[model samples]
Target: MISAVVFDMAGTTIDDRGAVYRALRSAVEDAGAPVADADLQRWMGTDKEEAITALLELGGVQPTPSIVSATFRAFRATLDDLYRADPPVPMAGVEAALADLRARGVRVALTTGFDEPVVGSLLASLGWTVGRGPAHTVDAVVTTSDVRAGRPAPYMIHHAMELLGVEDVHQVLAAGDTVVDVRAARNAGVVAVGVCTGALSRAELEAEPHDHVLDGVADVPALLAGREARVGVA
Candidate 1:
């Protein structure tokens, strides 16, 4: 039986692609550098500083604290705009599924490529107070700052599992909307469930070692139940 469920926030639990893109573009543009949507997409799930460094290198410009700070400020502004205009909407069944999991005694955790401050801010805007809403309500949350590297590194997932006191990888289910997420789960030896709600495609996700793929987050419970039944059958 699965003891805990770990989730990726950006594209998995909440839809923030537009905000992310807008913020990233504003930052890049503030540096007087041109940015394209394709390039922005490539930077997803990556560390912001790293992305800035890469962007600087590509532009043949040296990275400076001012540049990085500008980018961050712009990104934050975009995020704030998005929240004020349209606070994130929890994926269908996510609220229900989380409640069900709790009812079933399954512990829940969250792992994201985002930094803690950003994650905290985003969750708060969505009414995810620690003792209240579905945002800060998880048992554990591992962010980029808490781990050695971002997704595809497995450090975040490992940290979350550790926080949750889960020793067996098979007892945990990892879900996300990107290939990096699935790859992270696989690297950590957990069940990786991919969703299409993010920028990645089903074909791209399947190219990795994910254990399961769903149309969206709504199918997680059913997938878990099916996996349990299969385990019993075996």
Candidate 2:
């Protein structure tokens, strides 16, 4: 049985209106190293710094510290501005799904490739604070700053598992709307659920190996038996 759930933020839970990508694309272009549209899409769900560096490498340029810093600073400023103008909304059915999961005694942890400041802003917008106590909406919030590496590396998922006191990976179910999300879950030896409510499409998500691919977060609870009448059923 899955006792804990790990979900990715942004596309996974909250809807940021593609602000992250816009920031990255703008920053890269401003840096005089525009990323190809396909490249940018491929790098989704990764640490911004990592993605920038990868883009640089793909462009046959070395990821100098100066270039990385400048690009990252630009990206952050752009994202902050976009978010300030309009705070993100939660993906359809996210809140209800989260509530249902919690009602089933399942602990929820939200993980993201974003660093502390970015994640903090999102949480604040949603009236969620960082803490492990029951008073918190989510059990925990794990960011890239909390790990040595981000998605596709499994460190983010592992960091969440560690903080949530989950020793066995199999007891966890992870969901996201990116390739790296599913890869990270599988890497951690847990259930990989692909949710196409945000970034990717069903066809793109199906290209990767996943345990279950659902339309949105709303269907998650039913799939997990959160909505089932366990007491009366045989």
Candidate with the greatest lDDT versus the true structure: 2
Each model's C-alpha lDDT? 0.76, 0.86
* lDDT of model 2, residue 202: 98
RMSD of each: 2.6, 2.3
What lDDT is reached at residue 57 by model 1?
Answer: 54
Off by over 4 Å in 2: 132-134, 226-234
The backbone clash count of each candidate, in order, is: 0, 0
Worst 10 residues of 2 by lDDT: 225-234
What lDDT score goes with residue 58 in model 1?
62
Q: Summarize candidate 1's per-residue lDDT along 1-234 as a digit string, tens digits.
A: 898888888788777645676766677777777776566666666666667666655655667887777767777777678777877777777777777676666778877766888888887766654422334456777788887778778888888878888899989889988766787888888888999888888997788787888888778888878878999999
Question: What TM-score, to 2 decimals, does candidate 1 have?
Answer: 0.88
TM-score of 2: 0.93
TM-score per candidate, chains pooled: 0.88, 0.93
